[model samples]
Target: MSKLEDLKTAVINGKRKDVKTIVPELLESGADPVEMLEQALIPAMSVVGERFKKNEIFVPEMLVSARAMKEAMKIIEPILIEAGVKPEFKALIGTVEGDLHDIGKNLVATMWKGAGFDVVDLGVNVSPAAFVQAIEEHSPHLVGLSALLTTTMPAMRDTVEKIRGAGHDKVKVLIGGAPVTLEFAREIGADGYASDAASAVDAAREILAS
Candidate 1:
């Protein structure tokens, strides 16, 4: 395989050191940053997510690979910004109130970033009021709420309600986590539900298309 393909393999294998090394070599060899991102990093993460969903890879593997992808991205992000490669969409993401769990949230955030959305991560234990405030501040096209515990799930509903109540009805709300289900997402009136990161990209695209 070629070096670009090797970069993809490095990310897939979760070789952070190799990913860091390869990115600069690729750049020095006159590879386009946008092409590197689109061709390698995004697709690598998407495959990782698919593996995770299929139980072919577990969370530890996913985390390392996602971390590797992030390593490459840190180098490319600046070049993209400097060259005016502004993300076509913005997504605000957070773990809802009373839920300190963030592994799932962080994974989703990283995958969203990999998918080329400018993600504003509000972090764990985010209150409904805080979600509303973030919506007011960022005006993102998509808002994602993650809750790992059954008890904390209502915070997702309340946040969604408040955002709609606040007259930000157009923005789509995407929900996910270990305990979250498709029926629950629909009952809570969310715009979409994704079981994993790769599907999250698909859901975000579908939501945007609608």
Candidate 2:
């Protein structure tokens, strides 16, 4: 495989050191940052996500791979910005109120960023009112909620309801986490749900297109 392809595969395998080393090599070898991002980094994360869903990989692997990808991103993001390659969509992401967990949320956010969406991470313990305020301010194409605990699931539902109540139904809502199931997502009035980071990108793309 070419250097870019090698870089991508390394990222998919969660080789943080390789990503850190190879990204700059690719740049020095005259690879376009945009091409590297689209052809390599994005697809690498997509594969990681797929593996996660298929049980070929777990959260620890996914997080490490995402961290590697972010390391590469540190080099390429500025070039993409300079080249005027803005993200195709904006996303607001957060863990719901009463939930302090963030690893899952951060993984999804990184994947979204890799997918070329401008992600506005609301951080952990975000309330319904905060979600509304973010929607009003960012006008994101998608609003993502993550809850790791069964106890915090209600906060996801309440946040969704509050968004609807605030008259921003046009903005799509997405939910995910260890305890969150597709049935629960539907029940909470979410537009979509993904069990892992890769599917989350696909779902976000579809929601934005609709």
Candidate 3:
């Protein structure tokens, strides 16, 4: 098989060691870093996302695959930046305050990266103030809030309210996690909701299109 296909298989198989080795070889062999990102790494993650959405793969497997792609990204990102290749869109993602869960948030972040959005991950237990500050600083087209516990739903609501009230009207809020639903998202004034990472990509794209 071709080297690009090998790279894709390495990511799909979660072969981080192979990815680390292959990425440098590809770099030395005149491979375009952006093409490597767009053609191989992202597609592998996109397949992983789809499998996760379909329940064919679970969080553990998804994490493994994402880590492999992340290794490749670590090598490719600097080259892309140095070459003046920037992603066309931006997103800010985080888990709301009082909720320490991050699996869902991390998955969505990976999917966003796969979909070519430059994602800023704010990590777990993000406060409303922090969200507002990030909005002002990043001015991202999309924001994602994750909460694994029902108790943290209120925090998600408060966060969305704070961002909206802060007059960041152009920023679209997206809500997700085990506890967040369409009704809850609507009540909290979120612009979108996705049950899994693959759909999160679709939701973000739709928000961007609108």
Candidate 4:
């Protein structure tokens, strides 16, 4: 197989050593950094996301793939930046206050990064005021609130309210987690909802487009 295709397979297989080796080789061989990102890295993560959505693979498997992708990106990102490549959208993500569950939140952040968005992860147990403060500081196009427990769902609602109340009219709020539904998202004034990491990419794109 071609080197780029090999790189894609290595990422899908979560072969970090292979990715670490191949990325630099591709760059030294005059491969386009952006092409490596858009073609090999992004598509590999897309496949990983689809597998997760189908239960064909679980979180452990997904994490390895994401780590491999991150390794490849570490090599490619500098080249892209030096070439004046920048992501078109910026996103901030965090788990709501009182919910320390970050597995779901981390997965969504990786997916957003894979899909070419510049993502700032605010970590777990982020407060409504923190979300609003971050939105003010970063001016991101999107914000994601995660709540794993039913109890923390109200915190998600409060966060969305605070973001809107802060008058950041253009920033779209996306909500998701085990207990968060489309109905809950609407009730909380979120612009979009994703059932899982795979769909979060699509939801963010759709919400931004609208």
- The best candidate in terms of lDDT: 4
Collision pairs in model 3: none
Model 3 lDDT tens row, 70-180? 899899999999999988789999999999999779878988887778999999999999999998899898999999999989999899889989898888888899877
**Over the full model, what C-alpha lDDT does candidate 2 score relative to the true structure?**
0.88
lDDT score of model 3? 0.89
Best by TM-score: 4
Off by over 4 Å in 1: 196-198
Cα shift from native, residue 100, model 4 (Å): 1.7
lDDT by residue (1-210, candidate 1, tens digit) is 888899999999999999989999999999999888888988888888788777898878988998898899899989999999978799999999999998878878877876778999999999999999999999899999999899998888898889889999999999999899989889988988988765788888888888
**TM-score head-to-head 2 vs 4, winner:** 4
Model 3: per-residue Cα lDDT at residue 157: 85
Of the candidates numbered 3 and 4, which has the greater TM-score value? 4
Candidate 4 per-residue lDDT over residues 1-210, each given as its tens digit: 899999999999999999999998998999998889888988998898888878899888988998999898888888889989988799999999999999888989988987778999999999999999999899899999999999989998889888889898899999999998999998878999999887899999999999
Superposed model 2: Cα runs more than 4 Å off: 148-152, 178-184, 196-198
- Point out the higher-scoring one by TM-score: 2 or 3: 3
Ranking according to lDDT, highest score first: 4, 3, 1, 2
lDDT of 4: 0.91
